[model samples]
Target chain A: MKAIKVQALSKKYGEKEAIKGIDFMVEDGEIFGFLGPNGAGKTSTINMLIGLLKSTSGTIEILGRNLETQKEAIQAEIGVVPDESNLYPEMSGIDNLTFCGSLYGMRKHDREKRALELLKIFQLEDVKHKAFKAYSRGMKRKLTIAAAMMHQPKILFLDEPTSGIDVASARQIRKMIEDLHQKGTTIFLTTHYLEEAERLCQRIAFIVDGKIVKTGSVETLKASLHDQSGLLLKLDQNMANLKQSLQEELKLTKVEEINERSLKIVWPPDQELTPLFTFFRQKEVHILEAKRMEPTMEEVFVAITGIEHSEEKGGES
Target chain B: MNKGIALLSILNKDIRNYYLKPPNISWGMIFPLAWTLMFVLRSETEVDLIEILPGVMALSILFGTTSMLAVTITFEKKQKSFERLMLAPVSLYSLMLAKTGGAIIFGILNAMVPLLLGIALTGLRAINWPVLMGAIILIAVTSTFLGLMIAVAAKEVFEAQTFSNFFRFPMIFLCGLFIPIQELPALIQPISYVLPLTYGVDLLKVAVGAEGILSVFLNFTLLLVFSFGLFRYSIHRMERNWMN
Candidate 1:
């Protein structure tokens, strides 16, 4: 069964459309990444799927149940870790987990057993008795995720799960995501970390300005932009007139000087390199190293959206 | 059946997290005890302690339930924990009942100490124990619903407290807690009829064998209607701002 299916889904706030009739599907047991910048309608889409926000138009089917009519049944099967970590601060970690489990109708012994097992898995067993207020930020994030998992949900939705955390904790969470996927848990993840999405998601959708620009596997996206890709060369010595000389000599429109000894030149993916090499040799650029620049997800995102990675954080194109 | 379990779980967590604190218990107890003590000590005329005892207990329940419900909702909203409840598999009805139910239970528990103390120290006795118990439940539920209503309109804890007092303070003066409703000025008598606490206080008067503005059946019916009406209103307001 498909974990989630959304068609013509839309959301409007006042006069502005937050999600403009976006459609997508998350296959069961796959890590489906919703890749977008902040306020790019990623949150609105997730909220609508989770039954928190009313969609302006369209239909959503989660776990084969209609979202509008069977929200409670769908909610029972899916776990959502919102953008915020919001466990009760005054309660102990165990207490919070137990309480969350109880809401799912877990029996006492079963709830306690599951809470303990999850605490150990999350490496929170040592501090299980401490109030949540005393927990570190990463620990709090983990606990919130753990709380969502207390009911052993069929699907999990994580929003910015590893953002703004220490590197060690982020690494652990990434590993955990991989582990969960391997164990046949369907995950619908939203993130700004392009590299993380590239590493984890089997398929990803790129959202910009409330619309999805592309949805495909990593290899497919990278191949799509291959023709516009560039080659980077590190020269033995600095060439003062390299930029002008390369553009004029090689008939290239995009040649950029990278510091003193490096130059990047764009060419068609299938173009021969011999001509460029001879051209550089004639100019005495004296290439020390040459390598093809396989586009990172960040680069693919930039190429598709025409927005810089840094500027994307502000959420406005 | 599942909703019942979810409701109980929510109530249990809320009681542990917000209601059973030492400060909450003391705050609920101190005001009524202090008020009753001052009234008894300052009276020059032959004071009927029995007549005043019910008012004191009613005030305790009123303040306890309303503040607990209002403050907890506002705090949960501010901290974003209320969204967790929204995401749970429980129905909205179960969630609302659980939240207000916790406040009602705590209010009744807080009232017991001051009530027993008054009965022991001042020789106060209930003429109709069942009516008194029913009145207590009615008042607690209605006041807690009022608190939830205020909470849905407020984004901050302080704002909720301020809005709750906007209703609570007026009811204290106009509900015949301190002075008889009939003795109030002619212009303000209509205001007493509108306030649910006026009916609650009248039922308490009936419980203690004092002459009340309304008959026992009338007060009981009015309080029930007010409680049900206010609870429904709170549910409506909550649906409008569920995420906020």
Candidate 2:
């Protein structure tokens, strides 16, 4: 069953259409990456799904209940971690989590036990008694995530869950997300880190300028770029003569010299790497490191959106 | 049933964070105590001191509710914590009610310090228990609603402080905090009638035996109307602005 279904969801802020009519579905228990450039309406759409913002028009069904008609039911089953850390700074971490748990009607003892367990998982046990003002950015982020998960929600919407954290912390967060996914929690995550998305998400949708340009499994998207291929070759001697011969003899698309003895080539996948090896052998040149380069999520993203993903840095939705 | 539990949980958190802390609780007590001391020292005549005691109590409620609501709300807005609350299952009205209810409780507690101190130091006479309780409830509700109105109108902390002061100062001074409305100029007395604080202080003074309880009831009823009206307006405005 689909855990979340959004159809023709739209939101406008004044004259600017924040989320142009868009549609998508998140399957139950799958880590679905809502991939998009900054300011691509990812947060706006998530906010609407959570009932935090009213959509200009559209329908959203969460856990098989219409969001507009069954907000309470849907909200009871879902949890949201907004991009910003919205916990009360004057309160202790434990206090924030317990308050969130109480909203879901958990008993005090049950809430406290659950909160303590979550704090331990997030490595915030030591800081549970301290006020939020003293917490670091990473600690705050972790606490926010813990708060969102206090009720053991069925669907979790995590917006940039590991942003601005250290590498170790990001890895820990990724491990935690994987653990949640293993336990059958459906996660709808929005993040700038394509590597994280590539590592975790079963399927990703690349949104550009309020429109979903592409959506599929990572392997499928990579296969879409099957026609594009690159070759890295190493030579024992200078390749100036060989480079010129290849440029003239073959329909080389792009050739760049890495060093005096190495070269990189880009061409259609249909082109024979064996021919390149034979050409190198015919010139009495040594061949080293000759293989096809697999496409990175970054490359796939660029190919789909026609804009480099790095260009959207520091832009928030 | 769950809604009641959630509301209680939120209310409990508000009280602990806003009322139980040493700094906040001490500040709440000190303001009213300071005003009580001033009134005791300035009351040259025995009757005049009795009159000033009720005004001081009213002032305490004003200061407690307005500053607490403004400062705390500004902090919440800056931290974006209110948005998190809005995302919860509780309705917006329930959230606002919890906040306003919490502020009223704090205001009542703040008002008590000066009234107790005035009775102790001045040996004030004939305190009508029912009238005084009614007056305290009146003042706390009106002050909190007014504070919420000001907080909702402000976009930033500085703006809230400035806007709160613009009305709070005049209401404190002109609404019989330091002087009786009858002793003020005729035009100013009419203005005082329009101010919620004026009605509040009038009722408090009547409770303290400076005026008639019947007159106080009339003023108290008007204050109730204003408080409810402002509370409704502020809640509506807040929902419009923050709930999206």
Candidate 3:
């Protein structure tokens, strides 16, 4: 079952289209990553899905309920952590969570118990009594996440969850997300951290200029590339002459020498590797190490989008 | 039921924060006391001081409701906390009601200090307890609604301060606060009738035995109408500007 389904979702701010006819689906209990650079409609798309900003034209279904006609129902089933910490600074962390939980009609005792458990999990128990204004950036982020999870929402929408956290905290957060997924929570995450997406997400959708350009699982995407096979060959010394012979004899596509003792080869998937090894032994090429290379997500992304993975500029406040 | 729960939670949180900080409590109490002391010291005669007592009390309520409310909301806006409230399940109407209610409660408490001082200093007597309660409620409600209007319309803290003072100064001056509205020119009397603070001040004076209860009720009704109209306008503006 699809937990979140968006069809032709578009949002226009004045004359400019922030999200133009974007479509995607987040399957139940799956970790879905929404990938995009700055100003690439990632946030706009998430906002529309969560009913924060009305869509210009489209349909969004959360937990099989239409967002337009059943916004209250949809919101009740989903949790949202906006890009910014939208907490009451004058209130304590525990107070913030309890208030959020009460919005879902949770009993005071249950809400208090849940809030305390979450505060301890997020390592905020010591500062639970302190006002939110006194919390650090990482602590505030953790508190916001805990607040969202207070009701055990079925679908969680997290926008840039690890954008500003330290390395240790980011790892902890990733582990927490994994735990939630294990408990059958469907997560829809948006972030610029491609490496994080590659590590955690089961599927990813790349959006650009208000449209989805690509969507697939990591392995499926890597397999879809035209150049699916790579070879890393380490040769013994004084085997330079065999490189030219192997290229001519085996019809290799391209080869590059690495450090005068190693070579990298690009070949088609249909090509047999055993023949190359047999030929090398017959000609006595004196091979040291030869292994197949798995493609990284960066290469797959660049291949699919036709753009390099440069860092996003201009931080959003 | 959800709306009620959300409203109570928000109100309780606001009250806790307001009281937990001693500085806010001191400021709320001292502003009215200082104003009363200044009025007594600056008067040339005891009769003159007694005449200014009602005005000083009204002025204290105005400051407590308008300036303090505006500054607090300005800070919330700057911190983006108001946006957080908008995203919650609570209706905008309930949120506005909670905000206005909290501000009015604070304003009434602030007004009581100077009110008690005026009675002790001038030997002012009260005829009708019900009428006095009604008038106090009227003044607090109207001033709180007006404060919300200013808070919602202004974009920045400095802008909120300027916008509050722009109307508050004239309202305080012509509403029989520092000067009696009847002593003003004929053309200015019409202006005073339109200002909510004029009705508030008149109602307060009547409540303290300076006038009849009937006159106080009349002014209280006008202030009620002003408050209802302003509350509606502020809610509309807040919904339009922030809830999108």
Candidate 4:
């Protein structure tokens, strides 16, 4: 079953289009990642899908129902963790979780027990009694996520779930997301962290300038980049005719002078590396070191979008 | 049934998080008590507590509801906590009801202090207990709804407070609180008809027999209309601001 389906979804802000007719879907129990930079309309799409903002055009279906007319029913079964950690500042961690459960109509005892369970899962049990205002940034993020899951929703939308947190917390949040997926919950995650998306998402979509430039699984995206090749070599000496000779002998496409001692070359997927090694040896290239490069998600992002991948270290801060 | 539970939960959190706090109580009490004190001090003869009771009670609801709603809504908006409530399974009506309901509860409680104090110290009494309750309840709802309208229009806490004062301060002087409506200039008399506080105070006056500028039925009808009208406007503003 498809947990979510969006078709020609568009949002316009006066003279500017924020999301220009994008289409996508998330299957039940699949972790689908929407990857983009700031102002790329990632949050706009999420907001529309969750019924917070009405789209200027197109339609959305969630949990086998129309998003426009069935918002309350869809909302009941879908948990959302917005980018901001927005729990009540004065309420304790346990109280915040319980309050969120109460919003979903959980019984008092059930909410209490669930709050305790989630507090423990998020490693917030020790500080459960402390006011949310007193929590560290990382703890606050974890608690916000915990509150979202208090009702055990079947589908979850996490917008930068691990943003602005310490590395340990980010890792814990990622692990929790994996656990949620393992437990059969469909997930829609939007993030700027290329590595996180690469690690967790079964399928990834690259959105740029209010449009989806590419969408596929990690392997599929990498496979699409197979035609574009990259290789790295370290040498003791810089050859004057390196680019020309490599082009002539090994049919190398693009050669970049990385540094004083390193060079990067683009070779076709069909081209054999043994010929390149032979060409280097024949040309008296020192060839101190050599490495074959597989495209990183960051590289894939930069290639498809023509935008440099400059996310904050450890996600968002 | 489930939505009723959710509504109570929202009310419970609001009361526990905002209304029950000492600072909130003190803030609500300070404004009305200060006004009462100023009236008592400036009087030439013995202060007629009954004469000013309606004004004090009306102002209590106005100040209390506006301040509470403005602060809570702006804070929730800034922190993004209100989104969670909007995303809940309950209707926007339920959420608005819970928020305004909480503000009304706080306003009534805050108003009670001055009313009880004046009754105890100056022997003021309500001639019709049911009418007094009806007037206060209706005023509380109207005031809270007006406060919500201001809060929805504002993006920040200070903005909410500033916008509230723009409406509140004008009503204080124009609503026949300190000066009777008949004594005001002929030109400004029509403005009192449009201000909900005028009807609110009149209802209070009729209930306690201080003076009835308008009949009981007229006062209740106007208050009811204003209450429902303000409520409709607030909900419209909220949907435009958030649920769009």
DockQ scores for all the models shown? Answer: 0.59, 0.52, 0.34, 0.68
What ordering of candidates by DockQ runs from best to worst? 4, 1, 2, 3
Q: What value does the interface RMSD of model 2 take? A: 1.7
Query: Per-residue lDDT for B121 in model 1?
Result: 70
lDDT of 2 by residue, B1-244 (tens): 2777678877788788877788889989888888888877878876777777777888888888887887777768788887777777777678778777888999999988977776676676677778788878878888888888888988788887887888899997788766777789987888877888877777777777766423765877887799889889998888667545
Query: Cα deviation in Å at residue A166, candidate 4?
Result: 2.0
Give the Å error, residue B78, model 1. Answer: 1.0
When sorted by TM-score, best at the front, the candidate numbers are 1, 4, 2, 3
Q: Which pairs, if any, clash in model 2?
A: none
Candidates' C-alpha lDDT: 0.85, 0.84, 0.78, 0.86
Q: What does the lDDT read for residue B167 in candidate 4?
A: 93
Candidate with the greatest lDDT versus the true structure: 4
Q: Give the TM-scores of the predictions, in the order they appear.
A: 0.95, 0.89, 0.84, 0.94
lDDT tens digits by residue: candidate 2, A153-215: 999999999988888778888999999999999999998888999999999998888888888
How close to the true structure is residue B108 of candidate 3, measured as C-alpha lDDT? 81
CAPRI grade, predicted model 4: medium
Model 4 agreement with the true structure over B1-244: per-residue lDDT tens digits: 2777789999988998898898987887787788777766665543466667778889888999998898898899889999989889887887889977899998898778778767776766445778888888888888998898888899999999999999999899988887888999999999988999898888888877776788888989998899888888888887776755
In model 1, residue pairs whose N, Cα or C atoms come closer than 3 Å (at least 3 residues apart or on different chains), thus clashing, are none
Per-residue alpha-carbon lDDT of model 3 for B141-225, expressed as tens digits?
8888888899998889898889989989989778776567778898897898888888877766665557532365577778889
